[model samples]
Target chain A: MKVRLIDLYVAFLKIGGLTFGGGYAMLPMLQREVIDKHGWATIEEVLDIYAICQCTPGIIAVNTATMIGYRKRGIVGAIVATLGEITPSVVIITILASVLTRVQDFAVIQRAFGGIRIAVCALIVQSVLTLSKKSITNTGTVLLFLASVALTLIAGLSPIAVVVLAIVAGLIIGKVKERRAA
Target chain B: MIYLELFWEFFKIGLFSIGGGLATLPFLYKLAETHPHWLTAAQIGDMVAISESTPGPIGINMATFAGYQAAGYPGGLIATLGEVAPSVIIIIIIARFLSNFDKNPKVENAFYALRPVVVGLITFAGLKLLQIVVYGEGVLNGRAMIAFAILVVGVLKFKKVHPLVWIGLGAVGGIFLNLGG
Candidate 1:
């Protein structure tokens, strides 16, 4: 059976509308929707998409939505899925902006956000651990992780510079491995 | 000149920020610090808080908020579209090429190499955020530290529990703790 663009749209809309804590937080939700719910892709395929989404230059949720959409229903699927993923945020922010101008300083709201800040920290830690287990499989990777942590936290280096350096390191490593095999 | 610059700046951000919204933070931090002078570091911190609590990608949330700051609604539209445009275009291109590209050995090697780098960046992001949350200007203090320790243990031990539950518990805990204080 051929998947329709509308199906892709609705699936992504659900993914975007409900999932919180950004891209990593959306993984389980996406797994449920795409793997168990829709059968659009296998778990392995989803993992691959996750890896690709991480490396590509864009929002991970959007990139994952686009990839899954394209996988399911081609170009039209991509467009609809992207629109679906973004629609919730756009609408919600607009509403929040209107309502928040008046009572943003209320003590209750401040307390709520203070709570959220702590939760955000937990989410970040969880994301790091999850990604580390999946991505850092070797000593080289461990060293890289340590170096990156040090650079950002201790050295006060720019993250962009670290990312660039990492990419260059990847290229060099790839060349070296290729030469060794050859 | 400002609108044009805004469009170009966001476009570049969309083009280069890999590994998702948090990945864009470094660039946005740089942008706020160096170029446009549209926002202060504290404002960026506030924007991050707003973005996290809100429904969208942090990058998009930031672009929209920053755009609104710079040129109101129209500017927000411009920034959002500009930030999203690159991914939309590149994904389309990659979609067309992905099948043939998937089997290429060099591409595979490149991706293999990239895995570690992505992890490193993500780890760095988490650490930086932790530093900010724990030790930034308004410190969380000893009470907050106890709460954070509990959260970490709860999450790591009970991996099956949903994150939203953790967030909810943290919120309730904060209310009670702050009330007591």
Candidate 2:
């Protein structure tokens, strides 16, 4: 039952190396590893980590990694997990930076990316639905979703505004529900 | 003046962009509009397209791309490192305190509130991208519509196909549609 630092590192490394399309895309991979593969935590624990990761002020992938690692081990686990998650991107970017200038306009690369863009769009949409299923279970949540969409698309409001508003609304709702239950 | 400013601007972006790389887009959009002026709005759009397609985190790809545009390799390194610093420091701190902090009710409620909002923000971003894909420059006309239809049906019906498959198929579809158009 004792988890080593290397176990934490390898777990996150596997998570980082396999995931594509970034933060949201990594969710399924994390679920597979943490919940399905390792049995380190349950699906709810993974979801809770994901939820906490979103609210905290850092990269979701790194944050989630730290949370999961800490859950499994301790503070050291957090360090290992964050490092494991980001190592691939950091190394790749370093290499790409070295030669970025010469191939900035490569055509086949552009075509491949052109296709990748569509896929990113789909992935983003899929993530939205997945999150919605979890968070928007009630009418108020649905209202928030619609209002957020309208504000973003029509009013062209900054996302920060929507986030702030949602936080305030959530606090009020949470307090009211608590009061009612009490 | 511009290159230094680009470095500083992206450094700030790197420092504060929480929740991952996609979270940095709003900041990048602001950067395009404000100081440095290294890239036009259109170029920022293109950068986003490229970042999404690449294998790395969106923020790192952007910082690297922007740095490369402004001052070559060194610039890319500085920007990438700068963006990463905040997360590194914060993760270390969170690691120190997270065990004691995890069960706090206020923290839990705050996350409960934030979850739907994150979904909303992500969904809004997707919609904006869809608009660009369907209506903006270089769109493959009806292909955007077709892709949307397929995505909706695929998710609703199968719901089990790995998203990477959808993305891979979409890429092929985009190429064919682009060629056809």
Candidate 3:
């Protein structure tokens, strides 16, 4: 059955609406909506889509919207899906910017922001834990993790350098693993 | 003229921002430096706060907000479009390759390798954000810090808890207990 444009739009809308923190936190919700609810994508596809989004430039969530939407419809599907993903931000932020300019001094607003920032941190930490649990499965991955954290955090190495090195390292490791399996 | 400049500026931000949404901060700061009229340092801090808490991608939210602040709704629209264009274009070109891309040993390995890096970048981003939130101004107050710890523990107790629930609880706690201010 072909999913209607509006249905696709609504799906992203719901995903974007419920999502807080950032792109990583949105993945579980995205999987539930796109895979479990609609069956537009499978688990493996979702993972690969996420990987692709990670490697590419721009917002991961918006890229997810484009890629998943394209899968659901085509190019047009991508646009509407992106629009759906961003609509909430546009509305909410626009309202915030206008209204916050006025009452930003209010103690309650500061307190609320203080509260929200903590929750955002907790969610981000949860995502970090989930990823590490999955990725730190081998010695090589462990070394890579430590090296990466050092390069990025301590040395202030450019993230792109870390990404490029990881790709090459991954290729070598993947090949070695494949040879062993074969 | 200003809209074109906005699009071009954000287009560059979208193009080079690697890792994830948090990576956009430096580029935004650079923008602020180059164009002081475009945004203030204080505005960027506020943008970070709002983007983190809002729905959609943080990068996109940032582009829209910064863009709006620069040139209203039209600026917001263009900046967002510019920010997202690279990913949309790149994904479209590469996604066709990805279905079978996973089968290739190198592609598979590269992705496996990339996961930790993604995790690393995310962890770094989270900690930095926590540092700012928990210990703003490089000085801490016992009560606020305690409130934060309690909230974190309470949220972490539920295995696989919905993130939205955390957001709601944080809001309620913030309002009721004055955890933030």
Candidate 4:
């Protein structure tokens, strides 16, 4: 099942151009095009790609597109698909950034932004709740969550360092648990 | 020089912002702290709104927006390239090998610890934004507070509604409610 580079580009282009809010929002469209429409990959394959995308350090949508394209047509496929995916974002945001900056000083725009700002706050709160529901499962994780919040908010520790420390903590906890089980 | 800096900064953001698009918020906030001339806290609020409403990854859009602010169109291009370079390189290498990286026990445990902490980081960033928009100068803005309350309820209740709808309502309300700050 050889997929043309052009086909890969077009498929991801539609995926990128249509989906809003990114992340999981792009999943349905991705499944539709890659699995249902083109048969480029199976459902399980798409799910696997998604799992990899979650842990990987990049935009999930771009990662998904890159992985799928790479599977279909190697490195060139990955590059082409990535370009297709980001084209919409670069174009749309560049235009909007230009226009918004120009008209940013207007009072009406300010008031609109005022309202938009509140909406943004609400959106962030929802994400916090959603992520907390998924992440805070046990007492250990609870402590980790609280400590992280305190470190960032109260102590002003760098999050990058916190992330690194958490990785170390996880590795150690995992090793200890493995020893106990053995 | 700005382009190089934007490239380097976003490259770091791309390399470390694991979890998802929202995960980039903390790094962007740090960017605001370190390079206030490039962008500000208020501009980040606006970027979130625009990114959510637009058709793209929020992380990429933010990088592009910030890059554009820093330099211009070329800056946006360079910043985006920097952001995606790591993804392209890492994923390509993994795909070449074609193994299930997530199946490893150590990888699984690392994620087990990573998720909760990442959530904490995102929560902190959200709180900072909330403070800036709803209580800038330590004085609560009444209209923004009311809008915030209503939107929170709206989001929780009408979970199916797209964010664009909420943003649209907010814009209209901002104009009509005279929510000028």
Candidate 5:
């Protein structure tokens, strides 16, 4: 079944406009709209896009929209989805920029922003938990997570360095496992 | 030509700052140093708060807000376009070779390695934010502890509770508890 470009724009607009949390927070909503609501893609396709977007540059949610849109309607589809995804942000942020001082100066707004920050922090932890369940499946993955956490948190290693190292580690592990199986 | 500068600056941020939105923070800090007019350190913090609190990707929010702040609405649009330009191009190129994209064993292995690392990245990002929100300011002080506890408990108990609900409750507590800074 074909998906209309307009539908692509509208659905992603919903995801972009409504999702409060960042990229990871956008995942479940993306799943709901794309897979459940519009039948745009399957579960595996979404996960594949997730992985691809992570390794690629740009905002993960925005990149996901680009990929899905491109799949649905080629380059034009990609543009529409991306525009839909970001239009709300541009408008909202532009407005907020104008009044950012007024809001920050307000006692109530300050406190509210602070509270929202903490809650957002909690939500990030929740994302970490959900993601870990799927990624940390074996002893090797467990070790990677531990090493990565220590390197990033305790040792203050750059995340890019960690990502590169993980890629190399993955290749070595894959080669070793292939040899063992053979 | 601040618009041109905004476009160039954010285009670089988009191209190099891999690992997603939060990853762009360090570069933004550096930009604060080099181009203080684009965004100040304090403004960066404000941008993060506003970006996270509002809708859309935090990266896009930062870029758009910074652009608007620096140049104007046109700057906002241009900066966003710059940020996403690399992504649109790269995804299109990869999409062009759609079939061979995922089937390669090397690519599969790379992702196998990447998944856990991303999990690690997200965990680190969470810890960093938690430190800032919980400890950066002493606002989570004596009485505010109760609000914090309630949030944690509510989140833990109701796994499916939308984060917006937590944010809303936090907002209410902010006013009631007179949370400032």
Candidate 6:
């Protein structure tokens, strides 16, 4: 079924604005809006799009919106959906940045933000733990995880370079397993 | 000049930052070191707190924050546009020409390995941020450490509570604990 570009924009705008904490939090809301509400894509299609988002670069939520938009209407749909998704962030953060700059020097604001910084670090730690639980499953993956951490933390390799190495390592690992099985 | 630089830098960030929103933190850390005027080590912590507390993807939120810090509202717009441009272009190319790329075994294998590595990158970024918040000018901030410990426990125990709540609690804790200084 064809979806209107305006409808696509509004749908994604709601998805972007309402969801909090980003990442997986955006998924269920996304499933509801596109599948149940708009009928833009089916469950299987959404899952496929989601998987594609995972391996690709950029933000997963934005990528998912782009792929779905492309499916619904084409390139223009992709642009519209992506714009809708980020519009909220651009507007909200811009406003926050402007206002915060004015009063940021206040002692009270400083103190509050000090606490907020702690909370932010805790949040990242939580994310690391949660991501590790899912990604570092078996021995090979565990080694890959450790090697990556050491490469960046100890060897001081750039993350982009490490990403490339990991891809090559994965391919070699996959090839060796295939050879052994054959 | 700054506008172009912001756009170019964020464009690169968009292209390379994989896995998820938090993945951008590693690149931002590098960027902070290179362009401390645009974003300081201390501000990175603020950016994280603000980005997590607000709506939308943290990556996009951060791009906006950095852009605004660099060149005001126009910079924010440009940086955000630059960040999303690569994703839009790449996704369109894949959707139009490489629709089955995700199903390719080679691609599958790469991602299988890439996932754990991305986790590592993010962990490294998290540790860096922890260092920034818990340390002040080559010395440790004991108050921030206490707040970090408490929040870590709070987050683990109340896994379902929205992060905003925890952030709010942290703000209150910071004030009472005299963390502002």
- Can you give the lDDT of residue A86 in candidate 6? 95
Cα misplacement distance, residue A131 of candidate 3 (Å): 2.2
Report the Cα lDDT for residue A122, model 5.
Answer: 58
Clashing pairs in 2: A58-B19, A115-B171, B14-B83
Residue A166: error of model 2 in Å? Answer: 2.6
Q: Can you give the lDDT of residue A14 in candidate 1?
A: 82
Instruction: Residues B75-173, candidate 2: write the lDDT tens digits.
Output: 666665566556556655665667445566766665566666666666666766665556666655576667667766775577777655665666576
Give interface RMSD, per candidate.
Answer: 3.7, 4.3, 3.9, 1.2, 3.5, 1.4
| lDDT (Cα, 0-100) at B91 in candidate 1 | 78
Q: Name the lDDT value of residue A150 in candidate 2.
A: 84
Best by TM-score: 4
Models ranked on TM-score: 4, 6, 1, 5, 3, 2
> Candidate 6, after superposition: displacement of residue A113 in Å?
1.2
Residue pairs in collision within model 4: none
What are the per-residue Cα lDDT tens digits for candidate 3 across A9-120? 9998888777875668788889889999999999988888887676666777888898998887888888889888888877788777777767878888777766777776
> Relative to the unseen true structure, what is the C-alpha lDDT of residue B94 in candidate 6, on a scale of 0 to 100?
93
* Model 5 complex DockQ against the native: 0.50
On residues A1-98, what C-alpha lDDT tens digit does candidate 2 reach at each position? 78878877887888776776567778888888788878888988777766656556656776778777766777677768776776666566556545
Q: What share of the true interface contacts does candidate 2 keep?
A: 0.44
Clashes of 2: 3
A1-182, model 1: which lDDT tens digit per residue? 99877778788888877776577778888888889988999998888877667657778888888888877777788878888887777666555544544565777755654555566567666766776787788887777777766876578676667766776777687889878989
* lDDT of all predictions: 0.70, 0.65, 0.75, 0.87, 0.77, 0.88
Stretches > 4 Å off in candidate 1: A1-11, A18-55, A67-77, A154-156, B1-9, B25-78, B138-140, B179-181
Q: Estimated TM-score per prediction?
A: 0.76, 0.69, 0.72, 0.96, 0.75, 0.95
Q: Residues B57-100, candidate 4, lDDT per residue (tens digit)?
A: 88888888888888889988888989998999999987777487
Candidate with more favorable, higher TM-score: 1 or 3: 1
TM-score of chain B of each: 0.68, 0.65, 0.66, 0.95, 0.67, 0.94
Give me the displacement of residue A73 in model 5, in angstroms. Answer: 5.6
DockQ winner, 3 or 6: 6
